[model samples]
Target: MSRILAIDYGTKRTGIAVTDELQIIASGLTTVNTKDLLQFLKDYIKNESVELFLVGEPKQMDNSASESEVHILPFITTLEKVFPKIPIQRVDERFTSKMAFQTMIDSGLKKNQRKNKALIDEISATLILQSYLYSK
Candidate 1:
């Protein structure tokens, strides 16, 4: 089976995660600058067989779209245009950041290490991918 890539899109940076070839065992791939996201995906896809794009959909507690949705929507449009064959799915990402932080603490990361925004983003992407896998 092809891999399912997960993206946690942020304004300044984007986090990426992917499942194994068997579509199991979600793992953090990397975090990239938002401006370089498409290029990163392009290069990654050249080396990997990706079947789907699982993007995080930020929403408020009341189920309304978050302010960041504006940014992600345009990116998604561009993504669709770039990779027409791959399907995209959005997973509700209400508290992934907080969960990532908790995971960092649980893992006993140092205070300085815990401040790594890129690491948090990567973890959040892994969580997003795992969420989709669990739902399936």
Candidate 2:
């Protein structure tokens, strides 16, 4: 099995996660600026055996698509254009950020560490990937 890449897409920053080749474990990769994401993915794909792309789908509490859907939909279109062979999937990311912060708190991270937005993003991506894996 090849690695599975998961993305927690945001307007400003996008968090990335990857599963092992066996697809048994999900781990945080890095957070990249939205402006640089396409080029970053291009570079990443050249070196990694990525089998799938999982994107976070923001949804409201009522199970409706969030306002960000307008932006995310276009991003997904671009992603498909760029990586046409790789399959893309969406997983609800209703409160991953909140869960990431709570995870940091539970993990005994210091306030300073908890305030690191990149760290939070990575954790959010990890949660997104885990959620996708669990759903499967």
Candidate 3:
């Protein structure tokens, strides 16, 4: 079966995650520059079969679109255009970053490692993927 991919998009960086072939577990894949995301996905899809793309949707406390949506919306459009064959979906990402930080702390990561924004992003992506899997 094709795996499901997840993305945690940020202004300068983007985090990626993917499910196992059996779609039972989600794991962090990598963090990439926002500018290089499209090319990165293109290269990834060439080697692996992805059945779906789950993008994190940042929403405000009132459930309205968050400020980050301005940037994410455009990226989503571009992603659709670039990979029309893969179905795309959004998962609420209200506190994935905070959760990622907490996860790092719980995992006993050193302060320096916890401070790595790329690692945080990757964890956030994994959280997003896990959320999607649970919803299904």
Expressed as tens digits, the lDDT of each residue in 64-111 for candidate 3 is 999999999999999899889989999999999999999999999999
Residue 11: error of model 1 in Å?
Answer: 0.8
Where does candidate 3 have its weakest 10-residue lDDT segment?
78-87
Task: Give the TM-scores of the predictions, in the order they appear.
Answer: 0.99, 0.96, 0.98
Clashes of 1: 0
Best by TM-score: 1
Please list the residue runs of candidate 3 whose C-alpha ends up more than 4 Å from where it truly belongs after superposition.
none
Deviation from truth (RMSD, Å), model 2: 0.9
Model 3: per-residue Cα lDDT at residue 112:
93
What TM-score, to 2 decimals, does candidate 3 have?
0.98
Cα lDDT tens digits, model 1, 14-36, are 99999999987999999999999
Question: What is the C-alpha local distance difference test score of each model?
Answer: 0.97, 0.93, 0.96
Whole-model lDDT, candidate 2?
0.93
Better of 2 and 3 by lDDT: 3
Q: Please, what are the lDDT tens digits per residue for candidate 2 over residues 14-74?
A: 9999998899899999999999999999999898899899999999999999999998899
Winner of 2 and 3 under TM-score: 3
